[model samples]
Target: MSGYRVGDIQLDEPVSVLPQAHIVGNIIAPRLRVAGMVYGSTAAHDTIILKDGQIWGDVHTGRLEVAAGGRVQGWVSSLDSADYQRIREEGVVPAIEPGAATAQDLPANGRSVTRSDAQNTLLRRLQDEAASALAARVELEQTFDKRLQEVAGETTARLA
Candidate 1:
């Protein structure tokens, strides 16, 4: 009517226009049926039906359907970038997350057994190994020192 007509355009029988329909700009839709006049480009996704209208611009679409008394003058292009931005903006995907798992919750296999259980097991094993190694080193050092003292005492007795 007032603004640009889009979507499906249907016509019943033979209808003629006196003044004629003038499309100042582009017309983008899935289908277009023109029986009057179009001065601008006409683009349709499925089909573009030009009955007896006079198109001034180019007609570029997926399919072009022309009747007996259809006339085109200007260039017509397909609807590619017409609704691309709207679709991209509307079709936004949100990110998903599994449950919460921290470093302390990891087991020996890096799997989550239990948070405090895994941490306690790791800490207890480390402490036990460190204590055993320290005790062995201390015993070896004491044995070496005692042997050195005995050798010194034997040398002093021999000199006397």
Candidate 2:
């Protein structure tokens, strides 16, 4: 394929295949049907149909229809007006001044980290903590179930 970023690639076809096409940016096409692969985020204004295609990034569209063979591995966001506004507000990070007076401003704590770094760290910590908690909960439930089964077995033996 061509070095098409698909930043503004528009298609009016009922169905289209972007095989061997590597899109590095966003896609904004309505009523489009794809049967290839997209490595970037997709924003469909109306509807998007995916057939045996792979989406490795985020998808923000109005209506998405995935065929039985289609696959999306990343996040999916709604394109509703309200959702758009909320995303715009929440997704945007305010610029931070390096000289701003804050505990993080102290260079002793390692050079002030970038916003992206902070976000990534927070996300990673949350993921780890959540996984740990889930594992602990599962273990507790299993132990409780085992104890209950043992108690039930003892009672049955005594009754017999």
Candidate 3:
């Protein structure tokens, strides 16, 4: 489909949601290719999300391939035994409208996130990891040196 649609979709054959298309409900298909936007969950045997595609709800598929720039805002999981039943009887889950922000998007600290905040967090983690690795290396060198000294002393005593 290449336009906007507003209902649940169920099909046995392969399905494609082309660019500029938008679907506002769940999709149940054996195979799917999405290059547009989906505002609801999808259950498929194979699902491919091309660049420029976006899915705002959960996806359950046996095999999934996503190209760079594809976006899925919800959970993704492999299909389970009960997925078939879900595909047949499931309803669409509520989705946040495009560009809308929800409470979940907020940080637990209740502070708005900025580019500096992200960069600072990444820098802190890297610094901590570097310090930890340096400490480990120092400890290993100390242990090796101590063992070597003990071995040298023992060898001298045995030779004497």
Candidate 4:
């Protein structure tokens, strides 16, 4: 990809992805004009998808214009009118700032979980469940083995 950034990019003005350019990350801006391909979502006050332009992720904007041959593969949701105007006037999203977000600022409902964090959390949970299941299986096997041995001993005694 030509304009692939490692993380999200925030812009104060309108941004355009040129015809030959492709971006792999999310974009945050007042407006976006795409003439190329974007692999990630976009949050902007206004978005125009030119001919041949494609977006593989969700688009969140107040106004969306798509020319012939343009395409978006994900959901498109219009932003609140007030928030759209505020971003245009302020040059930034109202609820988000340009700094590191603290834990307190992040919600607890897993909305802000990164890919790695989610993967780690899932791995740990699966491991714990697997261990518990294995322990239960072992206990069940032991109980069956002891019962079988007792039955065998009684049968032998009766025969003798």
Candidate 5:
């Protein structure tokens, strides 16, 4: 509540979300650093840091910092820092990993992939596929409901 901060910056009250914590609902607070699983959206007046966690819903905050290993399936929106007329905002900056870089950032000279790297690649692909399937299922359910309602409406009109 007190010592939780953003990099070298200090916040009045910043809540550090733990890895064991799984929130089924949204979180609206001054500052929040996510190291856990969040099933719902997260909105922070100051900042929201996604550090090695999964967020299934949108994230809205003044400042956002996503760690290299973090996963966010939803949109991330933020207001301009200059527009912050309230309390001074502090960012929960994630620690920089030594070799955290995208494929584009890597040198064109490709090195042979190691066994561990290949395993990790496969694991990430599996995780992504599962997430995609889950999202598709939700979409399919919504569409089915709408179609069912339309069919019911047409049948009622025909009977009437």
Candidate 6:
């Protein structure tokens, strides 16, 4: 869509927001290409592409591609291919019942976990997040190269 403002968009198929479009709430889509601005969360099963777009909240995606001028100011969590496939098949992440057991509350084998362990766990999680972000940037560079190659090929084909 073009030149529109929306709130809380959810999609089961592919969707794209053209440049200058603005979305004020969450978006859930199989594949999403953002060329505008999104002020809230986004979850994509296949991929999330930001081409000169801006996002101010969390993003959860299978694959991510951000162009040179694109900007994101919040967290990004990448799902593995298997997770993406599952999401595609199920249409949404599995529902976690309220008050479900979590690492913070439960210890493996009922062992007593301490505050130090929690701090260490947090540290590790942060470290992993940093690594994931770095990996995403690397993947973006690789994707850019492939895109450049495709563009060159198209140009050559047109000339021929």
Colliding residue pairs in candidate 2 = none
Per lDDT, the best of the predicted structures is: 3
Write down the worst ten-residue block by lDDT for model 4: 92-101
**Per-model C-alpha RMSD:** 38.6, 17.7, 20.6, 20.6, 12.6, 13.8
Let me know the TM-score candidate 2 reaches against the reference structure: 0.42
* Deviation in Å, model 2, residue 24 alpha carbon: 2.5
What tens-digit string does per-residue lDDT give for candidate 6 at 1-160? 5544445766668878888766656677778888876766677865455667876666778778888889775656777767666655655443222233445676676546434645655654664465456445545666799999999999999999
- Candidate 4 per-residue C-alpha lDDT over 36-146 given as tens digits, one digit per residue, 9 for 90 to 100: 877666789889999998876668798999999998765576797676666455544332222234455668874464445455456545544543454455456667999
Better of 1 and 5 by TM-score: 5
Clashes of each: 9, 0, 0, 0, 0, 0
Q: What's the lDDT for all of these models? A: 0.47, 0.53, 0.72, 0.68, 0.56, 0.65
TM-score of each predicted structure versus truth: 0.35, 0.42, 0.54, 0.50, 0.42, 0.50
Per-residue accuracy of model 2 over 1-160 as CA lDDT, tens digit each: 2323434344433325465444443454444455665555555545444566665556676787887878765456657766544434454312222233445654876655544556655654554454345445545666799999999999999999
| lDDT agreement of model 2 with the native | 0.53
What is the alpha-carbon lDDT of model 4 when measured against the actual structure?
Answer: 0.68
| Leading candidate by TM-score | 3
Q: Arrange candidates by lDDT, descending.
A: 3, 4, 6, 5, 2, 1
Give stretches of model 2 more than 4 Å off. 1-15, 81-160
Error of 3 at 147 (Å): 85
Candidate number with the higher lDDT (2 or 6): 6
Q: lDDT score of model 5?
A: 0.56
Q: What is the lDDT of residue 102 in candidate 6?
A: 46
